[model samples]
Target: MDFLTLDYFIKLFNIILIDLVLAGDNAIVIALAARNLPKEHQKKAIIWGTVGAVIIRIAATLAVVWLLQLPFLLLIGGVLLVWIAYKLLVDEKEHNIEAKPQLWPAIRTIIIADAVMGFDNVIAVAGAAHGSFDLVIIGLIVSVPIMVWGSTLFIRLVEKFPVIITIGAGVLAYTAGSMLTGDPFVKGWFDENPVMKWAFIAIVVIGVILAGYLKKLSKNFISINEQGQLTIPDSIKNEAQIEANDSFEAKVDDQGRIVLVKVAKSEG
Candidate 1:
């Protein structure tokens, strides 16, 4: 495809989407790993970990792209893509956000987890690129930090609008289907019957949506406890509490009476 052509743009767009979706989990892992450190250490850990993650991700993606050029490797990649897409759509929610690690430990954990989990990212990007190096690199450069910094926001948005997750999952499944069709083992089949290739793509996309919808329905019936100190059930209520705290103060009257009261911080 010509670099400036519509096909190129579409390919780049899909790469960006894959990067955005897969990258968020890695970013969250980094943030959570660093969250328990001393404030200063936490900042350092995030910065250094992000830098390390970027370098590792870039290297891994390049390696995967190179390997993908081999005959039949695309079939492996395509199967991996489908697995990743399914996991993204149906994986259980991560309830254990890791405590902040010590400086060296946090960095180590971040690097190790990212190195292992990052293959999903690399394969997804490679599939999206359809073997275009420039497009893959550009997509990574643009989407990585957005995925990192904006992950918390993305998580909140997913909670607020659950359909976004379903749509994102469907996109990944579509990308997976495309990857499968492009595989050397499948290429001839796809070429001979383009309708079959399109049918597979439709099945993947629809299957993801149906699965997500059913999961969403089941989740609705599984009632989460609405009362918890750590759980913020409503953003408005949470913001109101924060504002109240920002303006709060203890006041003393002439008789030494305490006029304003708030929950006292506990010494853990």
Candidate 2:
């Protein structure tokens, strides 16, 4: 496919979308792994970890065409993708952020977790790429920074508006179902009966909702920083909210949670 064509652009978009959805947990893992390192070392860990992850995903994507050629492999991957989507919707354990301040260990942890957890993500990206590895490479290159750096913002958004997470889960479920129907073993079956494709999608969507409800019964939504390792300082500097000329006072608890934030009176 030509890089400048509309079909290629659409595939690139899908690849990027799949990566972002799959990257939320990865961002958290990176943060937790690097939290204990010195500030400079933390940066290094994120850089190297991201580099390693990108390389690993690229290599995996490159092998997708060959791997998918094996009988039943696509079906097995689709089943795994459904399970991963379910876990993404429901898993809520707070990762232990306290660790030795060694940088290499942190980087290793990030890489290992990323490699293990990225199976479904890699599958989704390969499906999106549609055998065009160039699209996969371009998409990952654009998305790695967002996954590495924008995790905090994405976490906060999910907390504030949980529907985002639900939508994300739905997207993953759709991908799983799509892959299942497209698997070569069953592709002929679905191709003959177009309605069966939508039926599989409905089944996957129902599965996601049911699994989420059951998991919710045993889980509680807590602040991401409930362990006190993550902190948010209350400071605002914006054109409409608070200018650089303005001052503010922030009240932080012992756990570093911001309890109050208010504009301070100017002291002449």
Candidate 3:
């Protein structure tokens, strides 16, 4: 119980290390959930969402022992995680960013996903802490900054290379499958039948990825009509904040590429 002992510091370091490694999935969920929001509000969502998720983690870590005893806890959580991964993947769009996105839903997603996905972290940290609540508190305190930085970094990465979202979803699905296999009720069976465990994991991961890809690809097709005049699709226009009768200046650049810029209205 001594705060300054080497053992205390070692345990704290272990807790921090565990959290750092486990934080990637939480960061991805935050990024994917907030990316569709306006740039100004994305920061708010990231910060608030992370705070809520951390609070949930703390509470879960505290009750993790008892929570583990609850029947079907891992099974139910794994199913929910699979659904969340699928939802996050399919809901993302190239031109479907909302001008007025709901903040709470994104925060809610972050909290629920983090809580479900955090069981590993909680158990890992709890084992490291050796029942020391003080270590738990300090460890979570140190993790907040790391979690925020991770979320922002992922958001930028997703902006540049969107495949990360799919990868992230696969990661979630894999974790979910692992959770399912580890559930107490099923763990005995899975241990006796390891091949079935691998099959279940493969099915969950591939099914989520394929279903999300197909759903995302099902966006409405938009094309110019035969009149030679291009009309903007409502979804694209709304995403771009283009109003009816909006004027655009088109130019052919040195690369022989066409570019369009919206013209600002003049004051009377």
For each of the candidates, the C-alpha root-mean-square deviation to the true structure, in angstroms, is: 10.7, 11.5, 10.2
Which tens-of-lDDT digit does each residue in 11-108 have in candidate 1? 78877777766666667788778878988898788778778877888888887888887878887887777778777766754535456458988887
**Clash totals for all candidate models:** 1, 0, 0
Tell me the tens digit of each residue's lDDT in model 3 across 151-209. Answer: 56645666798787676677667767876788789889999999999999999999999
> What is candidate 1's CA lDDT for residue 253?
84
lDDT, candidate 3, residue 32? Answer: 74
lDDT, candidates in the order shown: 0.74, 0.74, 0.72
- Decoy 1 TM-score against native: 0.73
Q: Please provide TM-scores, in order, for all candidate models, with all chains considered together.
A: 0.73, 0.70, 0.51
Considering TM-score, where higher is better, how would the candidates rank from best to worst? 1, 2, 3
TM-score of candidate 3 against the unseen true structure: 0.51
Better of 1 and 3 by lDDT: 1
* lDDT score of residue 2 within candidate 1: 80
Clashing pairs in 1: 36-100
